[model samples]
Target: MEVAELKAIIEGLLFASGDEGITVKQLQKVLGISKETVDHLLEELKYEYERRDRGIMIMSSNEVLHLTTKPEHSDYYKKLLEVPQSSRMSQAALETLAIIAYRQPITKTEIEDIRGVKSDRPIQTLVTRSLIEEVGRKESVGKPILFGTSKEFLTYFGLTSLDELPPLPDTDEPEDINQEADLFFERFNDELE
Candidate 1:
C-alpha cells in the first residue's frame, strides 16, 4: 500500500479507537512492512499533524501509543467530563503502600517485615483496586510477585509520579492491625472522604 493510504488508515484507527492506539508492530505486521518503514511513516503522519496544527496528536510512552487532545482542549472536554469520586484506601493499604513505594521494588515478605504483620489482605486489596500492580517477580525461593503503584495510584494521589511521595521517617515504623478502623479512614484525606 502507498504511504498516503497507510497514513490515512492509521489516522482512522486512532480516531476510531479513541484512547487506545495501534502500535508500530501492529501496523507493520498488518501492513507486512518492516518497523523502520512503519516508523518513517509515523514520522510522516506526525509532520502531517504538525502542518495541520490541529488540537489532536499522536503520543507514545513506554511503547504504548494513543491519540489525545491537546491540553488546551481540556476545558472543553471538562464540560463533557465529570470527575468521579475516588475511593479511600485502607490504613493497612497505605502502610503497605508506603513500604512498597519507599523500599520497592519490595517483596510481600519484606513489606510484612517492616509492618511486623501479615500484609497479604491489604496487598491483595490494593492489587484488586488497581492501586498496586505486580512489577516483577523476586529472584528468591518462591519468586514472589513484587508490587508497586500504578498510574491510577498516582492520579488518585494527585501526583505525577512516585517520586512526589512525602518522605516518611524510618523511626516511625508501622505495625499490623488487621481491622484498625482509624487506619482505614486515614488512608485518604478528608477531601477524598
Candidate 2:
C-alpha cells in the first residue's frame, strides 16, 4: 500500500483503540511495518494534523497511541456538558454509573463483566459528564484505570454520600439481575428525570 494509505490505516487503528490506546509494537505487528516506519508515519500524521489545524490530534501516552480532540478546543467540548438535555444520562450510562457507585474503584473490564455488555461509550460519557472519574489504577497487568463516583455524582444524584445509595436486594435464591436493576432505577428515576 502507498504511504498515504498506510497513514490512513494507522489513523483508523488508533481511532478504534479508543481510550485504551494501541502501542507502537502492536501497530507495527498489525500494519506489518517496521518500528522505524511506524514511528515515522506517526510523526508525519501528527505533523499533518497540526499543520492542517485539525480539531483532533494523535497523542501518545505510556507508549500507547490515541486519536483525541485538541485540548485547546476544550471550551467547546465543555459547552456540550452544560446543555441541559445532555445532562440526562442514557440507560447504559446510568447502569454504568450505578455499578461504579456501588463498586467504587472498579476497572472497565469488571464493569463490563457485571453489565454483560461493552461499556466503553457509557464509561466515556460518565467520565466526560463528571459523574465518574479515574480514582486510581488497578494493580494488575496493563494497570487499567479504576473508576469511582465523583463529588459531582453525589450532587447530580441528590445524595449526601454513597452511603445514601439504596442497598442491593438480598435473597436466598439467585436474585434476578433485571429485577435488581429495575429496583435501582426505580429509586433513582426521580433524580435522573
Candidate 3:
C-alpha cells in the first residue's frame, strides 16, 4: 500500500486501541511489514501531526502508540467534564457500580450472584457511561469478561484513587448487598455535593 494509505490505517488502529495503546510489534504484524517500515511510518505520522494544527496527536509511551487529544485542548476538555451530569443513575446502575467498585475485576456471573438477579442491563449502562469497563477476562470456562471501575469513575467521584473509596464492611449475606450499595452511593453523592 502507499505511504498515505498505510498512515491512514495506522491512525485508525491507534484510535481504536483507546487507552491500551498498540505496540510496534503489533503494528508490524498487522501490516505484514518490517519493523523499520512501521517505525518510519509512525515517525512520519508524528511529524505530520506536529506540523499541522491538529486537535489529536499520536502519543507513544512504553513502546506503545495511541492517539489522544493535544495538550493545548485540555481546557476545552475540562469544560466538557464540568457539564452537569446528564441524568441521575438508576438504582440498579448504582448497585452495579457499588459492587464493581468494591469487588472489582469481577465478572457478570459474580455480580449476578451477589445481586441475586440478572445484571445485564445495569452492566450495560455502566459500560455505556464509561464508569465501568472490561479490565480482563476470567481464566475459567467461557472466560467471562471481568469488570472494573475506570479512570472516568474516579474522576466522576472526585477521587484521586480507588484507595480513597470507603472501606467495605464485612458481610456475606446477599440481602445486605443493597444496603452496602446504598451506603456507597450516599458517600459518592456526598462527595459530588
> Quick one: best TM-score, which candidate?
2
**What TM-score quantifies how close candidate 1 is to the native fold?**
0.46
User: Rank order by lDDT, top first?
Assistant: 3, 2, 1
Judging by TM-score, tell me the better candidate of 2 and 3.
Answer: 2
Q: Write the per-residue lDDT of candidate 2 for residues 35-112, one digit (tens) a residue.
A: 999999999999988954588999888888889999889999999867666345678887887778777889999988
TM-score of each: 0.46, 0.55, 0.52
Candidate 3 C-alpha lDDT tens digits along 50-147: 85577888888998888988898899999997886655677888888898998899999999898876787789889988999999999999999999
TM-score of 2: 0.55
Superior by TM-score: candidate 1 or candidate 3: 3
Give Cα-based local distance difference scores for all models. 0.73, 0.83, 0.86
lDDT of 1 by residue, 1-193 (tens): 7878988887876665444466778777777889898888888877776744687778887786777777767898897656553576667777787677666788988888877777777888788778789999999898998888889878877889877766454454344332232343355545687
Which of candidates 1 and 3 is the stronger one according to lDDT? Answer: 3
RMSD of 2: 5.7
